[model samples]
Target: MGERGRDRSRGRPLPLGWDEEAVPADLGASTSRPVPGPGGDGEAASAPASHGWSRLSRRSRRLIALGAVLVLVGGLLIALPRLLGAATGPEQVTREFLQAVVDGDLETVRAHTQDARGVSTAALTAEVLTGAEDRLDSFEIRHVAVEAGTATVTAALRTGTESREGTFTLTSSEVGAFSPTVWELAPVALPELQIDLTPGVQEIEIEGVTLPVEDLLMNREEHAPRIAVQLLPGTYDISVPQVTPWTEVPQRALEVPAAFEKSEISVHDLQLVLADDARAEVQRQADAMLEDCAASTSSIPEGCPFAAWGTQEDTPGTWTLTSSPRIESLPIAAFLWTLQGAGTAEFTPAGDAEPIEVPFTVSGTAAISGQGALQVSVPAEDSEHYGYCTDAENGYITGVVVLEEPGQDFSSECA
Candidate 1:
């Protein structure tokens, strides 16, 4: 150390292994500079600057902008219609459903409905509904109300010349997590036509359109056949096709109310009127059968009501129909007209000079069962109204036999 406290290490031995060469050459001068990197330059090497947008070519940038625009447009296209539909709300949905029915758009109608309870939906077809002459003419929406998640739409439907007001119920549901709500009509029990018909009836004409009964048959309730037809608000004329020589039902008009107004139409019994000629035809058939039976040579004609015997064993009685059977009334039961009448047959024994008149009552059915043709059977001997005339030798015909001959005693004819 120097006396004045100045370091004299330059001329004297450095203390504690200090090396003057390792020290900076110009340590007292002030200087600032970056440390050298592995490349040995005074400043660190840097890679080229990379900006994503700047890296793309000009045309590529234009294409990217167009793609973004298309995505935005596609999103809007998908959302716009849903937004518009939502704006119209349930009232519009109700109107659309009714319009679909009138348009005969079955797919749309099914989509809008929740549950359609009808035994037979055959008449609900687009073709059938469109072809119906009594189909709905038009509809007008009167009012709309919203409550909770449900909606009520009041409307009037015009069918033919008649108009009726009714209410429709609807409920809303979300289509998807991102989609707008969808409205659907609530459960609608379609109107039913309960028609009372003869069991064998095959077809019926409604509004001048013929439909098979088997296709329209929905159910049988209270022993009456019920046909379920999805009818619009309209008046329909229904008639059974002519069952020839037996029964026919004239066209009857039925007014079907709205779906929610009245769900059922109990069309009164299809009162079958006996055809004017049917009665005469049945009568003629009965008389012909009786006459044919009387023509037999045997004492008791095969199916005839009378039997006569001669005193001798070798002789048989000759029989002839004195009075043809007359049909008093033809009452139908189970598709058959039961005949009630009486007839007379004269029988002459071979030895007797005079003929004995035998009176017989007739009772049986005129059946058309399945084949559309008529068949009459009026056998007095086998039927409930059996009457036979015989002498004491023939066994008694049981169950209150009556003698129509004023002078003849009952014991002689019955016993």
Candidate 2:
């Protein structure tokens, strides 16, 4: 039995359980195997592997191909929208910027600009937005075009009854991960205020501050003076001194817009005729002067109207002003004025003598005194007649006195 066992160990094979075929399959062998193809060589010798693949059902093959195709298409779908968004980011930012401006969202607008230094958001909202919104009826974004981190946006703006198109330009830059692309706006310059005045406006006052006309007249364009001034956004009360005696202009109120680059204000229409009360007051003072002159016992009383005449001796005749004085020139002030006028005076000789008529021109200053009394004064000139005359010769009154009444001429008898 030992010889037979030794022979079996040496020569005879064991059962299938202990044979090499019984070893477990290697996990890597299937993957490491060469793929089969039509090329002739060792690679073609591996063509038998294709037979196993061919054994699969047609439906299974189609499912595998479709899954592969879906993977490729899904990857592109995930990446495409992000790329498109980056490309159009500037345009989106521009649209948002304009929307903020129109809505008066000043904070948001400031956030979108890099050059917002010294810009007041409150001023923008209060002055620019308020004024624009009051006039704007509608607003719409027309188009947005983006290129190379810069964008231009066009919009249609309807203000009052007018419709206009406008444009805004914006730039973009990378901010951070959360906001990869941030946009900004260019700096805007402050605005100017241009004032156009009437021919005789000597000076202007704004907010109790006087502005000289000569200074504003510098850099004049043609004969028309340029009154342009640089000012911050605000409301202003402007006043111009009187230019003519017959008219008084009122103060002008103006509101400067925050967004205005340049604006014009014209003061041509502000002139108005002198008030009736002022005109009547002046006429009354002149009439009182004439009456005082007629009642004065001296040839020329101190406050008399004809005191401007250089007569010395007391004339033995009753004097009367024959015509209403015509005011030729007047210098206006806040509460005083200098007035000049012409009239005729008649002197009747004491002993039934013919009356003599004299023409005269007089100038006097009138004012409201402390006691609410209107005081008038005629300033005397050297070698000229004024006040009570002590002595006079070369200052003779020479003009003819032609007195025309409603129905008769009193100077006709003298002629």
Candidate 3:
């Protein structure tokens, strides 16, 4: 058979079940086979990759691949509609526009609207819109119509319990032959607002933004300024900030309707009225001054509104207040506030003289001296012959009474 077979036969005997003569002669012979090489010549090949992959049948691998493809296609089918809905449609754009208004997204709303001439964007801010009451709460697309390159979308808008139908017009244009259609909202014209404010207010606060009257006035130096502004449909708060500790103007919150009617908003005589606390403080100070005057025993009290003048030379008298003076009226002026009140004062001259009771009125001027403190000035007694006029309605006394030579017609001198 072969030299290796003859060597194995001479060395050992075959097993019991193995037949030596029946065995093939080429059983132990060595042989060589051709293997592919990089150059495609006959050479030994490198070992193959893992046998696990090689053990898989072609049909099994193809089946697994087909299953994976089906899974991917099913997922795409589920998500395709949502992705398409987000990208293209005029109805989608209309919905987005309404949603942006509800969200107070000024940028998005401006992006959707077409450019208009003379559009005022000063009040077109998210903060202003957000501060408004009865703003757009929700919306639903009711109808959509497309004809030629023009489209109209009607939406049901709701604010609070009020519902209204708002229609939007859109125009589509092809940018180029190969480009897709582009849609934009048509220009909308809204109403204008004309505001007339009072004189004392120099500045106003609307939706957190401070507006000065000088800037808003048609004529820069006008006493009572007017502000003309165009804003989106919303309610706004207009108020004057606290300019002084003694006075304030009431806050006004007005709503600018969505209708196209020209509206005029006027707020006149918003006077710098005295605050409650300031009035109370003024009354307290005035009361204290009168109390000190009543406690004085002299015939003429210095720096006091009331005095017991024309008394006998050697007679001492005491002035007592029967009714305390209260601040009945306070009138405000540029730098001073006038205070007036009416009360009864009793003056009793020495031992045997009867007490004289007079319905006396006091008038004084108060001003803010420094650090918000009040400085009050009242008339005191002096030697003179003068006529005093009494304003019963205003509780003010205007006069000059001079004793020409002590008790020279004291009653005739006062009027």
Candidate 4:
């Protein structure tokens, strides 16, 4: 075979017992004795990956590769450079397509694709190079050759979790450039990965960078001087940070926040109903919720905290005749950990037009030592649209409530 030799891995798994030249020399000889029992030599044994990998026994995985090799090794050398000539036909253009890839220039790579997708090669190049630094450990382009209008090349790449050895091929593109067609969207089965979570101290690893959990959680907005967590139904040991000491939470932990003592909780209602006056209808719903809160609690002027705080005016079925929209349903939560509640928000329109139905919830988690609860919820709308508590029971949001993603707030965005 005049095939170019592939570099063998340092360690390999070929059967040591098999004589390299014996099989062919004894091609027609019958050897094994018919054992009387159930088993013969049995099926071939598998060697661990660490030992070395073997080629797939199935024909499917090797079809494209085998065909490409057969055509190239025939000595009708359609050398890559000439195939990628400045004004070569599409078929001739297949040979040196992988050169652009080895050069790490996406613009040139995109131009070599068989189907340009109507997108500029420069744009395609930009997409491939984006976040590429985060994904690759090492990359090397070995050889480029073309058979017909397709190109094949050998490349070594290190994916973050593991090292993969495979051949890359270029699909013919309508443009002069050939694009790699490796993203066929197969159910890529990766090896199993496991991580253990510690209570107080968080472990963080971003690609090649690793940092502790405390550093990530540290923010002026949440200056958590101390944290205590409780992992329920206790089984695992609590490991606390020494300087920023940590402890594994058991089930429940009484959280004494950095700057606050008693954490307050409540939910706010924003409703919209169809009526003659859409604007008034929305105001009416807001007022009704506020009125109920005031009547229930004795901490408001005229027993109305909203009216006292001017969160909503103490309007009585007031009708403002204007062309505005009627909101459907809106609910938001406000939380305060150290005190009763946060301050207030100045009212603003959701958009240039009318408002739409939106659900809103905010919650917080506090850790006292090793125990902490992730609280989710329907929030109390007295002050801040902040996820400001660490109590699980009070903070956990369930049901029809809309809990925003960890770092987002619907209060202002949804208005």
Per-candidate TM-scores read: 0.51, 0.39, 0.44, 0.20
Per-residue lDDT of model 1, residues 1-415, tens digit only: 3575574444332322222123333556422224577777667544234434444555877788899999999899778767876766878877877888777787776564434354555555554465456566688999988888899999988766667787888888876655777887775555767776654455677766677777777765424555666665556677877645466666787876655443667765664556767777877877777777777766666565556634344247678888877786444333455677877888777674588777877776665433345556666334232233322443321212322444444344333
Which candidate achieves the best TM-score against the true structure?
1
Q: Which ten residues in a row have the lowest lDDT in candidate 2?
A: 382-391
Report the lDDT of model 4 for residue 351. Answer: 35
Ranking by TM-score: 1, 3, 2, 4
C-alpha lDDT of residue 136 in model 2: 38
Question: How many residue pairs in model 3 have overlapping backbones?
Answer: 2
**Model 3: residues >4 Å from true position, as ranges?**
1-89, 112-120, 190-193, 213-221, 230-234, 258-273, 277-415
The list of candidate 1 runs beyond 4 A from truth reads 1-83, 110-118, 208-210, 220-225, 243-250, 259-262, 271-273, 283-335, 339-364, 369-373, 377-415
How would you encode candidate 4's per-residue C-alpha lDDT over 1-415 as one tens digit per residue? 5554675434434444322222223335443223343354554444444422233333543675678788876534344433434344322232233343334554554343333121112212333234233233354555655676566555554434444443545444442234222211111111111122232223322221233434333121222222211111101212222222221112211111111011221111111111234224334544453435434322122432222232244322211212222223222211112111222312222235232222221222211211222222212334322333233444321112123455554333221
> When superposed on Cα atoms, how far off is each prediction in RMSD?
20.3, 16.9, 21.4, 30.2
Q: After aligning candidate 4 to the native by TM-score, how far in Å is the CA of 5 from where it should be? A: 76
lDDT of 2 by residue, 113-228 (tens): 43323222232333434533233345677887879977877777554445656566778776543344666654433345456554334567666565665555533543344465
Ranking by lDDT: 1, 3, 2, 4
- Comparing candidate 1 with candidate 2, which one achieves the higher TM-score? 1
Q: Is candidate 1 or candidate 4 better by lDDT?
A: 1
